[model samples]
Target: MAAATFIEYSKGTQFVSTHIYGSWWFCMLWGALAIGTITYIIKMRMHSATLLLLHTSFIVILTGALITHLFAIKGLVHIRKGITTNQYIVNNGKEIKTLPFNIRLNNFNIIYNNGTSAPKDYISYITITDDKQSKDGYISINNIFTYNFVRLYQTSYDDDGNGTYLTINSDPYGIAISYTGYALLFFSLIWLLIDPNGSYRKLLKSPLLKKGMLCIMFLCGFSSVTQAASTLPDISANKFGKLDIMYNNRICPIQTFAIDFTEKLYGSSSYNDYSAEQVLTGFIFWNDEWKNEPIIKIKDNTLRKYFGLPKYISINQLFDKNLGGYILGPAVQEYYQGNHDKLHKAIIEIDDKVQLIMSLRHGEPFKIFPYGKGDNIIWYSPKAQVPKSMDTDKAMFVKNIFTLLNQSAHSGNYNQFNSLIAKIRIYQEQNGGNTLPSVTQVIAELTYNRIPFANILFMINITMGFITLLYSIYRLTSIKNNRHITKIISYTSIIIMLLSFIALTYCEILRWIISKNIPMANGYETMLLLAWFVMLFSLIFYHRFKILITFGFLMSGFFLLVSHIGQMDPQITPIMPVLSSPLLSIHVSIIMMSFALLSLTFICGLTALILYVTHRIKHDEKTIIDNQLSSLYLLSKILLYPAMSALGIGIFVGAIWANISWGQYWSWDPKEVWALITFMFYAIVLHKKSLPVFNSPLYYHIYTTVAFAMILMTYFGVNYFLGGMHSYA
Candidate 1:
């Protein structure tokens, strides 16, 4: 199944996915598994009816999915306001699929984020009518409408607000059957967990387990950690560092603003220990590449054929009193001298990465025509190479401000420079007409030192997790009374995990307060929340199952480390329109939490398998290995129940959200299909104990370790490799 999913992902086609599942041999294989399962149940009369239904639910789900593949109708309907459309595009725009009913778009509207044009939601108001009935409704991402067995989902809208595009799917027959299977699967697993015959009920009854659960519950409450308001400083410093300017729709201290600006331009926040503010300051006033080397030395001559005629030009030449008389002409050199207004007028935008550098260079032979008849030619005039979409006023403001900055850097005129920054702040507020605060532009330097605790917390998590794993192994193998020290270290690790959890929760909340919305709207925030869930659940399960502490620490530490990578750097940004649903927060939390639980289970399964293999080879410590294996098997079992259940619920909730937002509950997008596959794979693993042929503990461990690949595909593969409706995730 993992191989098939990867193949489908590589192909980037839904038809390829259907081909894998809809193949005759695939059906036959599933049919055989179903028949064999039924036969075993009938012959053995399994002790648990819930187990029988759980196993049978797979067959039912496959039946529904196959029905969808063969009979479902999926297409796209694009409509403008007051326009009625019965035909929709299908087969990748090759043909038209006509619905039995016609849909009329009454109105299309979008809700924008506060003080910004970024859309928070896209709503399509529509009415559907057939020969027998008529229905009027509205649809948004996560909100859908059904009429005459067909579903409509609002997928996108024209930026001009003149048209709305919706995806329509008619798979009434298969969806009902599939949903029935979904319910049965959900209930059957819940029954297995709580049933008198189940192992979970036995584990829950233990006094030690119950007490441990209480402590875990207490620790989980740290999710609500809060912080006090911060006070801003008003003092003499870098003037540009004090002025606030908005970037990426986030309001922050100028120090933070500089970091984000540099990140966008240089693809990193800092270089050679110089913070973004330092880089920006140097770029504007002294020199951009502030090193011993001559800035902007035209050493790469290419035979010196591009420019009409020029000796080596260095930025140092600008300060040479004779530059205006020595260079190409006075008109160009005068701008580089003291004519701040003239220099500002010559600035123009070229690209986002070189916004500051390109604007500073302006007209002095900086434009390189890299292709065509004038390839590699350097244009001396700003008008010869300026982009049509350049915001001239913004460029001018930046240039004039930087010119004052250069003078201040040269003569130490701090008061004048500071006043100019304050004056510019007022000008930007009154005349800039930007949604974000003008203060965001202040050239304050910032580094990772601000949140040293966050760094320390992550280190504690990883280091403690590693130490606990080592201690856990020592406990497994040692014969001495190390319980006291082990307990101490264990408690200390738990304390650190608690602190880390609180710290992360605080950061997430602070972002929510600043952004005025839930923080799970992006990848970084979602991953952070996942780390919290892993720690919380691991701590919760720790008391009842002490082995989980090691696994939890290792997994949480690893995931948190991944979250800290530069790519996942948690920068506060605007949420996309489709992610504006109220259900988005709940939906993402459930799914991420489910993945965390399953990750711990995967670790337990791997440990069990290793112990079993080691026991077979050594033959010396069979008893100890068996004891460890028993505990691990039980832990994995206990963890899998909730993991599978949560995944199932999350998938269904996502479908409901999809229907509300897109108008269809199921679209068989790569991500959606993989999620279903993951749920079913775990369901089959749950029934492993019921079937004698697969009752061995080895099978249990192997199945779990392998089935985890499905979750990996659903979470990572779908996002990076497969094309899907859930691509926004």
Candidate 2:
């Protein structure tokens, strides 16, 4: 499956799906596994219903997949407005299939975000005619239309909105079986967690495990230094930042926009002493001076050397005065003409940065002045063209508002500038009205931006986490027993972590309120949520497994670090219509929680390995090392039951979501394949009798430590290296 993902990138989904996943050999492999599982269950005389059902569910799911591969008819159909279509193309356009009913596209509509051109949803109204009987229905992203055992999903639409394209699936038996399997899997997992006779429960009841748990319970708890002052006039930039504007398909405070804009251009939200708002104000009011500021970051060494530019280059530096044109103009042209080598890609990237700065200089992103009424309202920048039908006075105000504000700022007339801002706010309220975000939401977002808790908390978390981890290890290893002092230190660390977790939770709530959606839509948001889950789980289980608190701090801190690394956008924007389902929230939350558990297991494995390598214990002290290793292995085993189950459940939940949104349960996308691989790879540790090596503490820790690589590949590697539909996550 892993190899298939990379191969699919080159050969396309159809080729890989046909030759790899859908091949006879793949089906045979699944058949062999199913047969082997049943044989093993019979040989071992396994009678636990939850365990039997859990293993049986995978066989059923595989059978469903095989049936789907053999019998499902998946295709696409494009229907023009007022035209009836019964034929669809399938098998990568090699075969055509006819539906039992004719679908006539009655209308196609693109629903836009309030005060913005960004599409919120695509709806296609259609009438299905079958045997002289007709039914009217609508198909949308997550809302599918079914008729005569056929499903139609909204795929795309014509640019002119006169036609619509939909994905068609006719797989009644396969989907039914697969969904049954999913339901069984879910129920069995829940049952296993609570089952009195389950391995997990049995292990927990063991005296050795209880004694080990009790024995360990006491140990529980910059990019650049550029000092460039803002050149904007000394005015209330904070007030300006508070004003609401249409940005990135949603209405948010300009404070959010300013922070994102500054970070995009300068690689940080602040430049020396000036705030993001101040820096943005400078660019809008003092374009010429700001253009010469060396704020644009060029991280590519080769690209920098090619242009003979510094690490951070000014907008003016990108313009070749000698040639009287943009320096990257010729390179960009070559890039468009199919010269897509590494250098060209880098050139295009730098060109995009330059273009962003140029857009700011032209005031293209300042869409603050709302005009028109109802659903037709549009937020217009000063440079945007105004309709002639608009009220003359309103149109004039929209055109001259920025110029007036600039003049007031240049003249240092604070009163006039403030008044102008107030007038614009009034104008927005009048035009934008209820479509605009509430003042409270605006204030919350502004406060959220100002806190920067993720930035500050990450550093503190890592520092305190390291200290606690080392101290805990020392206490566990050394003969010294300074219980009083260690207890004080542990409590202090716990208090700090509790405070940090509260702060993170508060910020997440504020973000959720501002976006009006769960904060699991993108990589940055999901990473933050994952960090929160780690801390949450740690706090929940730290009493029993005290070292988890230290691991939690380190893991959460590193997750935050990954979120901030590279070019992650921290902006809270609206998610696509397909992602607006409640199932998506549940799916991502479960997955993130599972990841947190898996992360703790990895840390346990690492700690055990460190003990094995760092300390060559004498015969007298061998018992201590063996006991510690045994405890670590037990901790990992306890974590694996839930971690593996959650991962399996999360994957299937995601499949259900995909089925609802895209007319297919599994597309074998790189992320999906890698996730499956991770689940199966880790499943080996659970079968200790079959894989007896895992019975040994040393081998168990080694296998788990290495098994963590699959988790990393599934989460990070799939996003960065193996691009897929789930890359947004």
Candidate 3:
């Protein structure tokens, strides 16, 4: 009944369900819905468009996720040097499949500008085919290839032609859900906006609206499905393979690998097909030339000929593991051609592309097999693209050429640093195989879209410190305040508001610059960049409503107070490759702008609290208090609406940017979680008019204080504790 049944993982961790669900998507969707609901219930008021966007996006995103989690196909293909002139190995996690069609690697090339010498970041290229059209794949960073619904990326490189390339794959199901979510969310926005002058009330109360809401609720239910879809699964197979070389007795997973060989035009692709290459016999040559490449007596003469000639498949030439198979692409062609052995070339795929080339050895022939290989499966040395000339016999170092294959690794692959073992194998009579390098070489290069967040503690702290200095000076100068002095003080407050705005702008610009070299590498930097943007824009409106300054002072002061109280993190410097991108500027900048924007509402609520705190002290107090409340009301009017409006705008913009870059409008990253929280914070403040108890200043201020806490969490707290992609800084 099941397409593929997986026995209960880890023996028995009980709970019964036949359909497999992915957590990455299912968990996130449900998480989004639950979080969204909680925010809606608490805030009480919301932008009809945002609610729609959030809901619709969730549905499509989850649907795509279901398709991905439920049924996604994955496999790998391999290419080898003269050995596998035929088919490439196709690797899948559970089973390795040998394809019928023979793929010949034509050539591989790395083209780069002559002017720049910066390790040619994007100059790699490769070509491979199914015996038909000349297909190609190229690699850069972040961008991979699109073949049908599957996108391919070059994951790694190796010298041995053994499988070592790594690739990132996306199941179309996730994208489908993502697209559906976007369609629904986007359409809902249009539906939300068509309301007439009285549309607000009508939209909120309509029966259709209620149904739409119900649909959203049902759509939200899909989160359970989505979470199961999005979760990353850890899989261990019976055989593992590298560079088309399989590890015996382990589950063979189809995988892709890359080769950034010692030379250019050498980047390529290779996969494992679980072939049985067993080493049948080994021979030791006593001649002094043995040092360079010991003589090997293969069991069968016919089998030995298929290996080409002593000149073509020489021992010394073929055995250098360090200078091994990392060579892929056109380099294989160039090497084979130069040596004058134009047989089948090695083919490999890098980036989303592939390359093919023929190769031959220039050194002496070392070992032979009886038409069969021993060590049925073993990691192979990336064969060296043998040169045109072989080292003379005088160069022999008395090294062991033939080795009996074994499980795990060759005699010296793992922790090769053991000198005692090296000494033991060094005995002249014993097979003293060369010391192979560590498996670390087998480790793939760590290149991701971005590391996703970190660093910048220094920047936030420095900015806070700078702003606090200005406030400290203003407070120090206030000795006696008559009405005239109050006017001057008001003007000073205006300056601070404007400066806060300026500071935010400056931070954004600096981040823009910083992100060019950092942050763009991952999702976290993008989020921080957005936060900064939100903070910057919020200031423009505050300048229009000067009353907001009273609250602004408290808000800014609170930030300063918290910084002083909390212990600072050490080394707020940039780290990780993904942290380097301009996207961080956009992501962090906007989010911070929202913080500055929504903060004013929190301040107004604070004023309301104070008003309630001393209500009985009214009458004359009303004059002074009126001064406060009047300022507060003017500020609230100017502040609350715009703050809410700006925050809403910032969030909307954020979602748009996220969709453009990541393809999904909203991910339940910590930043997203906070954005929802921040939106709801103001939503409650705006709708509180419906609640009598909250009408009192004290209650308002108390709620505002709580809201402020949420703001703090939305900005700083999430990063500090609740880790997510945007948690970087």
Candidate 4:
């Protein structure tokens, strides 16, 4: 039973994929999809043994994930502090399904948060069990217990109050996730110098080798493409049990019930007492039938038959649990009233702190009157109760859904709420109704419990890609490119640009199959999406200025790589805190555009350095043949200048975005540092006097390598090691 987590697709189309079987076995789908993906890669007519081998690791990763989960347990073990006797807690660690047995915790410890809200530490001593046989052990974060196939992460606490709170967990899929991670990391390593954009020596003297390399490049791309496959479902979103969410709609017994200020305090703030009116935050459990409505009689009262409300009391008789009596606190005098119509228009004050406002009347939802002004309320409730339906309201349909919800709660099938509205419209139509299931309920389901932290797959793969990119640049400088080298650089950049653009677009669109109005939340996602925009612009601008095209491609690759790596964030996590801002999406999109544009400048700078070192240039030959060719010096002179200009403009626009989002012109964050560094490198490359220690071909390649390294340091290194604003996971 999933607690409360995203049950279906987020609004974005990038992270979640659609499957016909209605199972969230995306990990499983990835395995099967990997097979088809393998076949597709082979069929691409792109055959290079090197490329094939380079990407084979990806297939291995898929194999690894399949093996780890289906055959082994790869989950985390939590450790906390608490116990009468020093021991361990061993659990079968299965979720939804009942775990096989319990592993006791012999001992546990806490690593306190040293600084304000900083990191803490955990250590747990645990013991494993199989029937009567048992063994003792202790585990911590990044520590494992292999015999029972368990990995332990110092996760949470279990306080026994008497200074004892220790707990631990054993995760089955933990190893599988790790294997997938390493597989991705390995793929990036192989891809760095071997893929289309890598720094491999272009042995194009042999046309056969060139063609073979082409095939290899395709294989690499093919491998990357497979990662887009789906995996396993933990009974999350698709199916509905007794009262799956499809049948419940948004109606639940867990209403945030509120009763207005019962009494106001009479004295000063220091010695003030307040009275509160309480209502059921919980749904009517078991036998309780809240038949306050004349038209409805929904009850399963056998649960708490004797539980009944006390006599309905006036404001003076309201209970004051905090103050031990009905006396009001000094600061609460403002709530003294007879009919408290304004109370229904008030925010809840808990322990004298402001909380949610009364957004409805008794048995009815409130009209959203803004802090002081608003005529835009969609609907307002007259009383705190369900509104009477219209003649075509399909009351029976509503009743059925609520019944399902009640039943699901009774049966303890929490995930069934994942599809409580399983047959909303069909029943509605059958019973005479006009409204159908909203798109949110048509196919997708969401519950916060399904995932913990952010979508981590992006965090690892994208980050690893950047590390590989840096290594690739290192490889690039050491290799000598003959005449064919230029051709490969020119051709590969263009082809990769095309591929990147398509892949980026597809990634962006895949976000929302069920449509929960969420964007790609991870930093990796933002980077990729932003890079696509950047490349799209580069492709457009590069076509206008030939030099800029090569420059822009390099820039796009750098930013995209960094973005991929920056997706890793361990400290930060995914929080759906109901971000209610109308301007957020627009502001974010604009910032993304700025990132892409700035990226274009970075590309130009790298191209300028590489061109300067090579000391020779070749046109597409097909385009400028039969004409007096411009000298290499003249071309380099012209290209570097424009490239520099583009870089500057991109940075300036990026500054504008920084100001709007963060309310600052710039922050010395890692990604920002790299952006600026890239800008400076290009600017210097344009000026003769500022050239680095090397001016020859070798030096040029070396500079290019260093420049891109700086890019990596800014992207992945900064994100991973140094940390920065862009270090979002």
Q: Best candidate, TM-score-wise?
A: 2
User: What is the per-residue lDDT of model 3 for residues 604-700, given as tens digits with 9 covering 90 to 100?
Assistant: 6554554445554443344444434433443443344444544554565565455333333454455565666677665675554456765554455
Point out where model 4 deviates above 4 Å: 1-500, 509-522, 530-647, 657-674, 689-698
Against the reference, the lDDT scores of all candidates come to 0.62, 0.84, 0.37, 0.37
lDDT of 4 by residue, 1-729 (tens): 010001212222112213321124756566676787678667775365544643564566456445543454223334233322323433234342223545566666654321111223445676666666877776543343444543333444556412323232333453345445444444444454345532232322334333443222221211111222121122421232112111111211111111111112211111111111111112122222211211111122321132232222122222357656633333244444433333322312221311121221132232110111121111212222233542334334443454675576567666674455455424333432112224444323222112211233234323433433333333333344343444454455556556656655644543333223345455655665666665676567443333434434444555555543443321112222212233344444544564454344344344335433333343324222111012212223333333333443444444434423222223344455566566566445433333444334334333444554544454455555554355554
Worst 10 residues of 4 by lDDT: 266-275
TM-score against native, each model: 0.73, 0.96, 0.44, 0.31
Across residues 1-729, which tens digit of lDDT does each residue of candidate 1 receive? 556656765675565646765578876887787788778778977766777787777678778877876788888989988899899998779898778888899999886553434566788999888898888899876677777677788788876798999998788888788778878877886786779867567656645345554333222121111212111112323445545443354333455655654554445555344555665555545543442212232322331343332333333333435554333234344545765452222221112233345454552321211111211111112225444344676445544555665576567666776777676657545433334333212211122324533445567777876676656554444456454576577677667777777877766666566566687776566767777788788778665665666676677776667666525665556777677777677778888888999998888888777667655765647666755555566667778777876787788778767656654566567778888788878877655555554356567778889988987777667766775667544
The parts of candidate 3 lying over 4 Å away from their true place are 1-134, 154-177, 183-482, 496-539, 542-544, 553-584, 616-704
**C-alpha RMSD between model 1 and the true structure:** 11.5
Best-to-worst TM-score order? 2, 1, 3, 4
